[model samples]
Target: MTQHDTDHALKTGGEQGYLRIATEEAFATREQIDVYLRMVRDGTADRGMTSLWGFYAQSPSERAMQIIERLLDLGERRIADMDATGIDKAILALTSPGVQPFSDTHEAQRIARSANDLLAERCAAHPDRFIGMTAVAPQDPQWSAEEIRRGAHDLGFKGVQINSHTQGRYLDEPFFDPIFRALSDTGQPLYIHPGTPPDAMIGPLLDAGLDGAIYGFGVETGMHLLRLITIGIFDRYPDLQIMVGHMGEALPYWLYRLDYMHQAGIRSARYERMKPLKKTIADYFRSNVLVTCSGMAWEPAIRFAQQVMGEDRVMYAMDYPYQYEAHEVRALDAMELTPEVKRQFFQTNAERWFKL
Candidate 1:
């Protein structure tokens, strides 16, 4: 935006302040260590965006480390641009493809420790503004549980982060049992972000160099979420607070198609016994899932999602470092909702969701 528009944001939005769904992976270096190590083990010259270093490099990682780091340091500048886009807080977490790249549970657990420790230390510098989302290796459920508790109770983390999918294992898979139970016991919602998709599907997508934002990221992440819903993960873990972004990843709108055709196809038997997959999905979306306005701010999408999910479940986020911070702030400010709804979307709802 323009200088005047930025000033307006500071005055109007800044006065109230918003919380950022920020990440360490956002600012991390490209995949020097992680990917180099992986290449060593695999004995091949695979140049994918597998590490934080890769994120900064353009090796087809959909990486945005440079932007994320620049944006993270732009807190004051961002506020100045927003007409008082009062960014009171930023909820931080490790970047994606975090521990998922490690093949062994033991190695993944170690990576989780290192990543979580580093994140906690960084956030310690800005306790008020930065809340931590603990990283967990879904492969080692017990260790993941221990570290999550440690992050929450010991480091004062807000919640835990699980890549949308782990090692081709969905969140609804049996491996997440301990992780789920521990999170439930501690009352911390799991913050699910997208990681690389399944290996079987990655080759074709990579051949076309369209593996991330252009198409795959949202679709892969959305599939994980769908599996979680369809498999009744929330039904099993009632208190689980699962989050999915990108305007609920096209689920809420497409829900009607399934709801109307519940009596037919592969989902029919389950629907007859389970009372319809569509209703279950809606209930899970409404009751368990929380959506953030991350990188998907089409006005109609935002308005309809808020109406469908309610302002309470919606949180404002810049997807900073990966997205244009100025644009995100402007998008929220420009939403033509009643002032009350704006307040909730801009600040209140996030405060409650992140418990800020």
Candidate 2:
């Protein structure tokens, strides 16, 4: 067998099987680090921002410079981690709250551009093992559209990755139409990852130590996605595709309930002036939205996602560097799926969505 075939065979339990492609992998540029540090030094960073960085870093008491070092080392350390974990390719994106933390549009755009350039360079150097997703700050919708075009058309990024909201603004707002239209025009999928909640919005959750992935990530992202659905984003841009990680942020489990509530709310004229969507919320979930098994390694969640979203819409991800558990591959392998389903989950589905 060819080397490629042999590797696939080793990964997929045969001699010429599936190649694993993790779509929700993350990285950070040194420039991004510098900007974040500047924010911290200037006292402009969000309440939990510095502490969040420290949580991921090696040092518990201060900014995890070591973790920042690892994020910047997209070359050796990251690739080594992937290799050890049986991941043949990783679709890399900027880490959470990437350029979104920047309140200045100009600064956000500059930082996003620099980060995208860095990601593109890394992917070019390791095309077989890496693919890049473009990063854009939504502070300027027009600029974000242009950057999405540039990143996908010129830099060859696989798609776009946006943290759930820009500052406190979510994607459901009409102000983001240009951004959605741009994504539609490029035919690149957009991955909506989570960011820490605005302090004012989730103060209690933050104090309860659920600010990050444990509970808050899903709560925030799940709400962001529901907002997209209720506010008619999918209705307006039918061609635009979006992805949410962490097993659809608990959406699949509540699919029927969401549909029921959506109907009930609209029928009640809850927001009398707001227009209702043409289709059920679950229709959009199956049609325009895709979900990944990022950071969530539980078997039941993955299986439930498949049940609701269908195997074709479900793909594998490790949520690398953050939830980079080595046993995840084994967990996926142990799933009660046929080889064909496994191939779709690990390879073909991502290839189809990200144009891999």
Candidate 3:
């Protein structure tokens, strides 16, 4: 990594860790479309889930295009701003909602491939300064594996960031088994970010949307991670590396409760293969899971993660575009830890996690 902007003086250029100006959830133009427009299935269907509609608003075609163009420029400007803020690299993905917006299995795969290709090109042009994570449609098991391989081999990406669930199907669904196998085989780090309409978004809660993401993204994602842990996905695929944004989807805070529940025997048979769900979760976090300081980079949270997962597993990141660089940079710049820990969060951990 190169030295950051000299004007903002601090001890930079150290090799302890790396920084990622992340915009993981902002790439998919379609992910923002309301579910009313892309109605994939009836509510009773297997993957029966309603999509969030209020992600963005209506606009004329030409005006929408112009707005998009401006957003792209703003994204680039954010990168420059990140550079000035002392971020060494920007680990960009095709935003969130991602390919799940496409209901047709074939179409989803196609759009995902295209998005990965475009992101790959971006990384190619600025290999030193930018890195990419592949996008894949997890609607089907077979196609998901293929897309992940293509992203890694063809696009030169380090890992992937994905929504908590597709439609209504959670991560532990059988639909993702083949995909999980390939990920374990290739050792691709799968990032699981959160995006689910709140309880109010469906049925009576239709208007209760946007409410979820404000504080609900973390809760929803935490629920998903809890399910995965209880279901023992990590036990089945011990090598699978999963990355959760928003500080491990509130895992650290909820871990003790999970442990107590297990001790209280709430879900006895659920965690059959693991030593303990809490231990398994923490071990996975320490061994296979990576966490990003996307929107929740509190000093206590970051420090807690450092002690639990060690400084090597936490990476400094701005949720960028959707989350400005300042939020992330300021978090790192203001972190009250040893210089070594600060360096690790800012640079070294991400360097190893993303291979940047």
The candidate maximizing TM-score is 2
Models, CA RMSD each: 4.4, 4.0, 5.5
lDDT tens per residue, model 3, 238-334: 7777788878877876666667765556445554533344354556667777788787757788888888887888877667555554534644665
Which tens-of-lDDT digit does each residue in 1-356 have in candidate 2? 23333233224223336888899988987677777777777888776565565355435543355456667778988877777777899999999888898878788888889889888888899988999998998888899999999998899998999998777888877888898988989999989999888766768877888888888878988999888888888778888788999899999999999999788888888786346787888889889999999988787888888888788999999887777777667767666678899889989999999987
The local lDDT score (0 to 100) that residue 187 gets in candidate 1 is 87
Model 3: residues with Cα > 4 Å off, grouped in runs: 1-25, 29-78, 198-210, 266-279, 325-328
Among all windows of ten consecutive residues in candidate 3, which has the lowest summed lDDT? Answer: 45-54
Task: Please give, for residues 210-306, the per-residue lDDT of candidate 1 as tens digits.
Answer: 6676556777888788777767677778878888777776777876674455435444564433444434466677888988777775678888887
The local lDDT score (0 to 100) that residue 212 gets in candidate 1 is: 70
| Better TM-score candidate (1, 2) | 2
**Candidate 2 wrongly placed segments (more than 4 Å):** 1-16, 57-66, 272-274
Ordered list by TM-score, greatest first: 2, 1, 3
* Global lDDT scores for all candidate models: 0.65, 0.82, 0.64
> How do the candidates rank by lDDT, highest first?
2, 1, 3
lDDT of 2 at 230: 87
